[model samples]
Target: MTMSEPLDPNVARAAKLDTATLSDALDKLGIAGQCYRIKPRDVNFRMTGRAWTLLYGPAGKPCGTVGDYIDDVPPGSIVVLDNGGRDNATVWGDILTEIAHRRGIAGTLIDGVCRDTALCRQLGYPIFSKDHWMRTGKDRVQVEATGVPVNIGDARVAPGDIVRGDADGVLVIPKEHESAVLDTAEAIEVAEEAIRNAVRGGMRLDEARKQFKYHQLQTRQEG
Candidate 1:
């Protein structure tokens, strides 16, 4: 989706759904979106917003700054930093956290690492990343591009793509497929809820599963 396009309402609905259901939807649709090896700093942390992507690369001869882009991020947007999964240097820190929180930015998602996590926890700001470290990215890495497509784990994220994350990790829903993905995910959630209700009402677990066609929830939908 273009940056100027208003976010789809389905994006908000998908945000209410967990990564597992969204992953299932993507699987059913044959889309690759599950980001591997990335996790939330705190399991309780959760974030959902349109992606505002940034690509990072090894610094040049003189090196470059780490986070001058924070001031440009819009509220409710997720800052997606692709650092090629580097764990040694952090692209996020307390200063960025405070500003982002104050500005109402939804959260930060990094394919690399972050630092000064204590402030993040204190402010209840969500941060999903590969890991955390104290070494700053100042002299090691620099922003290669902004408002461009970037990789997070194995998933490709573009500007305005819907980014949803939680304890299970992050998944990017391609802007073009947001509607279909959210529809499938909501259906799956409904079917699973029904199964739980049946089991609670004394139905055999196997019986409930069969009634809900549980095994077919993630099966690829046929044309």
Candidate 2:
């Protein structure tokens, strides 16, 4: 990568905003992007990248491997693993964490759980999941497909969708809605900042909010 190549505009824009602001933007547009229950391994962790989705399911008589797909994920992409929110098995672990950190991968978001929490934290690699456990998914769950649409919490994340995560949690912005969502999120951020500035300058909280239209920022609009 050189000056000849430009950063992805959506990715760049999403990086400036947190998941909370983005969530509000999603609501204002009536788009479902908030992922419920999923949380970051560390509150300080943050990541923004396009999603490279993997769907997992209960293994058959002969189980499949859990990590081969990590090699195929492009650098700067978020690996989204959907295991049907199964806590009994772990689809991610130490090996994958080390490899992803070395490969320049943005991070990993699992709809289920991950293992090797110490390794991930030590490596400073971002991982957002329902929980972490030592159990492995090796003989329990198998990859149903790669580069496919998957569910993360209550949100639907398609391959190539913008996946951003922070201390609050993770959220997916569909590729088709990325532009609008980013625009709306930026506006909401601006309005909120204005409200804060007003308060700092001596305006009442309610007055500042009203002046900036803060209350209506996340309200859905009519078509």
Q: Which model scores highest in TM-score? A: 2
Per-residue CA lDDT of model 1 for 61-170, tens digit only, reads 88776658888998889999999999998889999999999988888999999999999999999999999999988889988889999999999999999999998999
Against the true structure, candidate 2 reaches a TM-score of: 0.96
Q: Write the per-residue lDDT of candidate 2 for residues 101-207, one digit (tens) a residue.
A: 99888899999999999988898899999999888888898888898899999899999999999999999999998999999999999999999999999999999
TM-score of each: 0.94, 0.96
Candidate 2 stretches greater than 4 Å from native = 1-7
Off by over 4 Å in 1: 1-8
CA lDDT for candidate 1: 0.90
Candidate 1: lDDT of 175? 91
Please give the CA lDDT of all the candidate structures: 0.90, 0.90
